[model samples]
Target: MATDTTTTAPARPPGTVSWWRRPWIAPLAIVTAVFLATALPRYVGLDPARSLVPTDRGPAFYPALVTHIFTGSVMLSAAVLQLWPWLRAHHPRVHRWSGRVYVASAIPTSIAALVVAQFPSGGVAQQVANTFLGVLLLTFTLLGYRAVRQRRFADHREWMVRSTALAFSIVTNRFWSTVLIAAYAPGALTDPDIGFGSPEIEGAAVASAWVSWIVNLMFAEWWIHRKPKRRSRVR
Candidate 1:
């Protein structure tokens, strides 16, 4: 009668909850991937005069622009993969390889960004905004790399998350700039002083640059600190 003494434990859920698995993250990643895919290649294909960079930019600008876009395109494309939880969980080797690519790409991208920031197309506010972003991108990325070296996984994750958000700010900044332009477009097109390309657009660009990373980082921090939902226990 002692043969039926053993009991089976219940199966646990398949995986842990993680911010990377948030529903919104994938869609946003897809959209940004698409945008960078279209936009970056166009610039990469174009000569300096026809590219996004100003025609009269310095000698350093061309090389810097190329480096920024090439590395940025690689970084951004790989970035989407980095946030995919399934990849991290099921294919950790791939995740680690992708992280290496990301960190390597960030090195040249951040350096190029800093170089280009010094010769901003917009005014003082734009310069300041871009410089802050460039420095932050470089600093945070290095910190993340250092954390990984130290085996501080949590710190690495946080710093790298911040770095990624800063990089992605380029997308958010452009989106915000477009929104601001659309808000003012009707008036801007009508007014002789503010038509098409003008200081008003530049002003919006400055504001967008500052707000994008700042807001994204703030949101990232909130997301990182958010309490995990407790799964119900079953007997």
Candidate 2:
């Protein structure tokens, strides 16, 4: 008896994707979400520096602050689109245009950050962190573009990853700032009041930026080197 000859189709694997690989989705989503959340607030009548510790720089500070907000908004917005392959392919023109905008925005932002670093209300540690941020911003950006120009995808990806990570330092700085304030200040922490006098708060912010970047670099290295190592092992 040929009972119930009909057979069910095999089940597909869970979490499968065809257009883009699964691993990339998380990073892209994170970068996009961060960009929108951070950039949108700047224009929504929210002051970026409201949470920052006040600097004694006086009126000159407003202009710098305005520049920081504008440039940072542009930078973050551009960064969100950078990692999406669709933008680079289906919309090559937009990609190139946005790339130019990203580079342009980075100049003023990096310069302003470096300038502010010198007089950071958090003192020397904040200054150093900002300096490193500025230098890395300039270095990685140039390297990424240069790699692309030379058709070196590997180098371009490496440098761009580093640059993107540094850009996220803005996010990390705020996150760490909040964490430190919560741990150290408890109920005393408030918006529009950066607890700059506390060395612990300042140090945490500065340290977070460096730590974030270093961790990002290590991850990138592992990603880039892993395949080669595996191939060598197989051979």
Best by lDDT: 1
- Estimate TM-scores for all models: 0.86, 0.70
How does candidate 1 fare on TM-score? 0.86
Backbone clashes under 3 angstroms, per model: 0, 0
| Candidate 2 lDDT over residue span 54-125, tens digit each | 645765665566676678778877877776665666777887788778878877887777766666665676
Candidate 1 C-alpha RMSD relative to the actual structure: 3.3
Give candidate 2 regions above 4 Å deviation: 1-20, 23-51, 58-60, 187-194, 228-235
* Model 1: worst 10 consecutive residues (lDDT sum): 12-21
Model 1's number of clashes is: 0
Candidate 1 Cα outliers beyond 4 Å, as residue runs: 1-21, 188-197
Q: State model 2's lDDT.
A: 0.68
